[model samples]
Target: MRRLALVLLLVASGCRNGGAPSTEVAQPPQTVRNPVPTAYPSEKGDYAVTELVHGLEHPWGLAFLPGGGVLITERPGRLRRIDPDGTVSPPISGLPDIFVDGQAGLLDVALSPDFGRDHWVYLAFAEPTFRGNKAGTAVARGKLEGNALKHVEVVYQQEPKLSHGTHVGARLVFDDEGHLFVTQGDNRVAAAAAQELDKLTGKLVRIWPDGKIPKDNPYVGKSGARGEIWSYGHRNMQGAAIHPRTRALWTSEHGPQGGDEINIPRAGGNYGWPVVTHGIDYSGKPVQGSIGRSTAGMIDPAYVWEKSPAVSGMAFYTGGLFPQWQGDLFLGALAGKSLIRLELEGNQVVHEERLLTAREERIRDVRQGPDGALYVLVDAPDGKLLRISPVGR
Candidate 1:
């Protein structure tokens, strides 16, 4: 049904080659899930933002544990634990050697879905090689033991490492079916590799928890193609989250100068990064060989911000703490300096609002805690972890 909506949107926006009006209106997807309660208190200016922890260095990703604590990944290659009461612990040791270059370091952190029993913590970082001094995204897993990591193992690594540090996308997400999905960037200059199935760059890869490619993956049994690829033709996708009800995988990726986009990536779909973009080069020139928007077989974005927000991390709101925000989507903005909220009616974005605009903080990540509160990670030299809750609570 969401695919139908995309087709209808493309037709309505006259994004087709001939610009002919579409006759078929797509029907909305049936709401099989229970309806979300609509009593929204935060929309009435009844909420308060509290700084929970401080003194962190550019915290990138955040995930809550099954019990109470939170795990945070610092971009400079450190993992820290924050207790439920807001006490920050010493950095966890036994991490892989990471390249601490610009936008290349420890990126995302997530616990195994069965963390309570398995105690596996998965990490993705920019790994440096000694041969060519190049770096690429790598995934590893470790066991939590007090203040250190134990029994660490590398799960996956992008092949043919590149020398650039700007676009090493390393967002991690677990789908509803218990498979791990990792988003990789175009390595800043390898946009052509995005269309190549043999390379893992500029792709969404799905794998089993222990670094094995799923036998049922889209590209399995195909010769010369990586079996782990779920989708391709992505730029630098930094934020990803699975939908609460629809079970769709949504992503926010950085565009060149003005075309940051949000997409519901499809299996084996081409997102047309440098091929067709709403963005231009950093010097305000058009993308090379760009046709402005749609191409022959590439998919169009579900939503796009004409002026780039430098979108970083995103999550779907399903918690009851903010009833009005239920089923909505939240995305962190690095250059826009706010938390952007999207009101969704099915897969289509119906409305948008920017939060924390006045504070002017570059939001790095957004997560809904186990206790139903929203936790936001700020991007700064001295980053902060903030908890946003009701004002009079």
Candidate 2:
């Protein structure tokens, strides 16, 4: 039905679906409409979407503690710790001032894999002003003392901090080798960085734990580009996860018109940004590469949304809670207002289903909390903290 809606709306309105303006339609805005889905459409969940922590100003990143509780970061430059029992810890101190303009601020927070012994948390954020108006993406290490971050030190900083914060794609994953993989969106201010080898914008980078550039990164020897780049040509990467068993790094990124992409970021892979896309230009103008033309060197997306569900977060389901969901992919959608579950066979997506669509809510993030339940944070004022566990046995 989702695919049918896009075709019908496109045939009717020429172009439609997503937040694209009518005048900017690559074709014309389609007027196709479809009924939304529901797990329990008759009524809201009998269980409360419950408030884990209130008073947070636009929280972005969420990480669960080993013993108990979770930590979240507010975009306005504060780190908070919330206990499962609903106790909100005071804001942690020692964060550097950020260039909090539009969409830029303190971002993704995750504890170190060695946290049990290290007592440290890792963070990504917009750095203090640099190059006048632009600011860099910074990764810092801070010690957790009681409820505050102490002995904070930035381990990595992406260059050309002058780009106004548009794409701060900061998701952290620790590879089996203990190296860190970090994703950064192509800060709208810099488009060329996506193709540039040395620059960090619009790229997924790999680094050593202490903030050192990994000696084995693909572009370490490339001149003019930063050394941490694992892949290039990405625009606003938001969803990323290390596959449960394959350990291959897969990422989901936002595209302009209809091309949102799921890519495997191999060393030095070029993902075809402005040069090529499945989507048309936002202005409805022609951009490079027509749809589905078997490009030579460039990698094709594993899955794409013609209607662009505006993907945000994703993870591979390995838990027994949703036995049917095992080995599938769970994705959060913003514009489509849905939770997309992609049925996969190896690297191929066989089928896709929506868990939440009619709600018209923007889902920002999804993760497996410490309690072994799937947790999702909606991106709205009525933003909800939904604990998606298996129906009680």
Candidate 3:
């Protein structure tokens, strides 16, 4: 039924009557996933914008190190490791050759669930296009060696890659059973590809450790589609995380001009993107009115920012550094140039507070470190690797 809604959206959007392919019109570039430029390291803000690490160019994704440190990935294909002492390690080798044009580049990174046992890590990155300018998103597994990736393996790659480079809202997370969840941006070109079961674009895909589509996935047993499909109707979802306790999945996605969203993902649910939006194109063209009349069967966002903040990374608070903030949802704002903390009283967004808005820095990612402290990555040439904790009274 959700797939049908994607079809209806394509039809309604003056795209086409059926899920047909257009030879001439390449899919929109992954505009939804592209990291927009901003004035990071804001000079003044409500919160103190401390600089953790500098010399980064266009940092976009982050993961905390085992100790008091962080691992940050720059869109230009460099991975820097920053220790709690503020020492920055050189770029880790063995990263895939990212298209690195616009939104395409080395994206999300995460340690293996049993990192203590194996020290393995996984990454979501875009590759040079197989056809046209379409660089496909792929997942790879490796170990962090001295200053490089070891035992690297490209577990999965999107097939029939298109010729566009945009909207690869790629994020990596693992379920309780150890299966990996990957959110692929719609390739920004193939909007209908979101509906086409044969293609992986604009889709939420599930795979085993080795990148094989899961046999028991919801879409398994269905015919004519990749069984890895966990859900559909997403434009470009960049943020993904599994609840440390509930085992539920949550995601953050980018909308066109205004309709950015945060969604709690359910298997087989459709998240309306171009079809149903809280926003329109940058041209002010009306793509959707409100969350009310999007394609039938599409799920509305749990919350939306009327003017897109271009949210990228998200982390739920589970640290002891701020006992008052435990269980809160924190998201990095790129276009909004700040860090947003959403207070929840059991799934109800009861409080909203904007941190570092005075700094006006483009926050690309927020994360909880191993020692239960908060870490944030700024996107800029002089981007800072920041640490947030409670100020002792």
Candidate 4:
């Protein structure tokens, strides 16, 4: 009884003097990151879509915390946080020097496999060179402390940073074996680099989480070949996800005019980016002397979209909130302004469904949160973080 009275007295005194922290968590800020009620139609009927966080500028990546928080990365080189209670924090400090160019900046963020215990996070960003003019994709590892990143370290960097912005493919994926895969672009300045064995650009690299080359990687001991190369001859690949059942790494990349492709990448494979494409150049001319769609030695995509939708981020749905969506792949589209759902049977896409067409939001990143809910980040001047769940679930 005395303890209860003392607690009540303390609460009263704290309220009177405004000195004690409230037991109640802070509410979502009214000016920013506020919940905006919205109803959007989907194949499942009218569903509930809530804008949980707003006022973000061109958000590119999102990762949910196991404890109920979220980390959002803005392409303009800022990393923001959303507390468990829905309060958005200011940009966390201690990020590495980011080269914020046209298509480059702080990109993807992923929690380490042992993140619950180690609290280590990884980021992919466009990094600058010694000259301070050229830049390319790089990966860094850091420890997340209170509200700042501590003990940050650069783990991997693509060589020969060039001075362009359109194609710094920056997606990070982790396999079950703890190997990290990084997707890079052709750097735009040299498309031929994609076919070269020595260059790291325009390729998928396999490395240990700490940036060491995996000994079993396809190119590990090959002379004149970068040791980290897992698969070569890729264009600007930005979206990659591991299939839940097959454990295969599937990637989607941008094509010239209309040859966006979805591929199941293979070890030491050549994707024939510029050599053979169904797309045409920006000038409406056939790509590279009309190389046709196939070559004897090059591999073909598992699926090709004749009309490019500008696919961005992707994830395989395994949540029970939407039972019908299990085993399907969800891809965010920037130019198409919709969330694409692809029904997969084994390794083939059986059917495709477009969702959120009415909202017409440029979905930059799509992720399945820890709570079995779907989260998407819109890319815009006034970007928003959205949560998607069943109407009454």
Candidate 5:
């Protein structure tokens, strides 16, 4: 009876239309046999976690500096520097006006690959309109000096800013070739925009560090398409990283209720969102305009969570501190309140381990420090910067 009711609800919500016929089928959902375990043991060794600092207001992003200091961004529109000895600097000044409402605000921070020579810092944030109501994701770059950003300039801005604040996907990643990849969400009220070629929403865009569209971009010379779009048909892609070995871009997207995804976003790839998805609506009904779980032309996710973990930041573990963990993938979970580690063989995830479940804190961002230690940012009114190391040595 329960299954029948769900089928009826799907039909009523119009879940079976507007998709190309396909022979491919979506992967079966994996159930969490044990939702939360007391301890997470790995093949390499046991883990120890240290709280380096606390008292942050919903810290969202983290970047390690050349001189051993860490830069952290708060979602409420502040940036601060934390020294190696755990001293937190006051909020850095000279950031542009940021839209801070609901899920919108200062999102991610990154240092330019040439930071040693250029000192350029890149930031992804929610940019507001002159009216200060509608907002969209934007990227800016500036030189860092003392406690402030100097000569900040907007590099890229998503078009058609929406009034809603949810689904502001703003993860920033730089590829080995010095191209900047910016992820944008569908703005909660605009899922259909993901499939539109001319719109920037729900897309992954690649640009030069100076915000110029690359000539080799998939849509560079295409008619009626945004030249900056590298790939389309994404949902809310909050987590992104470049594979250390492959140099390919991997992203983690948030689905409506379930169906959180891990994807390798290829140039011009279409990742089905409302057209095909493994998840239903928040109200337990099928997503509107969704056909089945697969479509003929859209690329299926490389990995999916049947139960939404509300994934956020992700990193590739290339550091040598954990020899066994090298080449693995680490992701921070907001809903699951844990750090997820996936063992990968090439691009395939063969094993998954959830860490820090005992603490039950929302993990926002995860990164490998200069010293090869795993660092994480906890999202809270009293957020914390945590360092994860081997139990000994």
Candidate 6:
């Protein structure tokens, strides 16, 4: 793999409350790379798809930089930068040791909301235990220097790391109040952990950028409950996006055989997982311990799929390029192998459209670029970064 050292313009760390430390580095000039374009038709209109770059190894998370650059994370513990012109940089250095195994490793990446000023980058990955036998999801942040991260520190870690590998929900999102939300999945072997307030598994946690637990967090003073927890009882959430109009945090979760869900998680909310679900087990039997589809204390999903699409990344389209798609929700589907677009009437999904079914690619992540176009990452050994723009625009 190419390991190019490109310097990024650095600024003084104006972080409050002793945030991640910063370093001084010089910036480099920007250049554009040629794009290979393809066209496709969608429900709203025809669009052109351009392959900006390729050869990524199971790229999972993607975050856009201030000046059209993108930071992408590969599942096998590598981070790369993609320039606007389609140039992919080499693996960035300074990441913590990741526990790479089945459905684990370097996962999601996000820029601090104040990235232009602070240059802080956040990451979620499967962190290994001392013995290297058990692992759990962890969140860390660092200052983005030239071609590496500096002063990286783990902000939060899941308690009681487990030996299993699957169901490590690792999506990161920042709410309107600047609070960071980290999604966690119930490590497949511990489904009941989702219902326990003492466990971080299968829960969404809210914290300050500097790792401080917010005083107003749902369980701050509750006995035996972790203060960072915001909501619980999720299976394996992989997609999260802030709603543009309502400013609420929305997420997509994977179901067993069916019953994939989209939820607007609220403070202290509990969306039933093992206790209740619409999906059956992989063996075609009912989910173990599930009493019914709905229960008295457990909150129901805002929307659910009778068939699992295996949703991953998600974004709310507020860009001008797709005016008709404004306020619509777009989710990347792994098993469905397409980009799923949902027409939303407030919080409800009114209509649905599946795009890129012809390509049959496992869409890993999706975001609307600053240029008013949609960008998606394909999950594969030879993954691609593709930009979708309205036809002839």
Best by TM-score: 6
Cα miss at 317, model 2 (Å)? Answer: 1.4
User: Taking the tens digit of each residue's C-alpha lDDT, what string does model 1 give over 1-393?
Assistant: 000000000001111121222222223111122212212233445655666556667778887776566677777666765543334455566766777678887789888988889988888888777543578888988888877778989899988677367688978998877899998898977677877889888888999999899998889999999999999888899999999888989999999988999999988788997788899998888887577788889999999999999999998888877787889899999999998889999899999988888779999999987766778989987787776665533
RMSD of every prediction: 14.1, 11.5, 11.6, 9.0, 13.3, 6.4
Positional deviation of residue 155's Cα in model 2 after best superposition, in angstroms = 1.2
Residues 238-266, candidate 3: write the lDDT tens digits.
Answer: 88877666868889999888888888878
Ranking the candidates on TM-score from highest down gives: 6, 4, 5, 1, 2, 3
Clashes by residue pair, model 5 = none
The local lDDT score (0 to 100) that residue 329 gets in candidate 5 is: 95
TM per candidate comes to 0.87, 0.83, 0.82, 0.90, 0.88, 0.91
Instruction: Give per-residue lDDT, candidate 4, residue 296.
Output: 86
Count of backbone collisions in candidate 5: 0
Between candidates 4 and 6, the one scoring higher on TM-score is 6
Q: How well does candidate 5 match the true structure in TM-score terms? A: 0.88
- 2 or 3, greater by TM-score: 2
Candidate 2 lDDT, 179-246, residue by residue in tens? 88888887876666677876778888899889888888887877776788888988878888889879
**Least accurate stretch of 10 residues (summed lDDT) in model 3?**
1-10
lDDT of 6 by residue, 272-357 (tens): 99999999999999998899899999999999999999999999999998898998999999999999999988788999999999
Off by over 4 Å in 1: 1-44
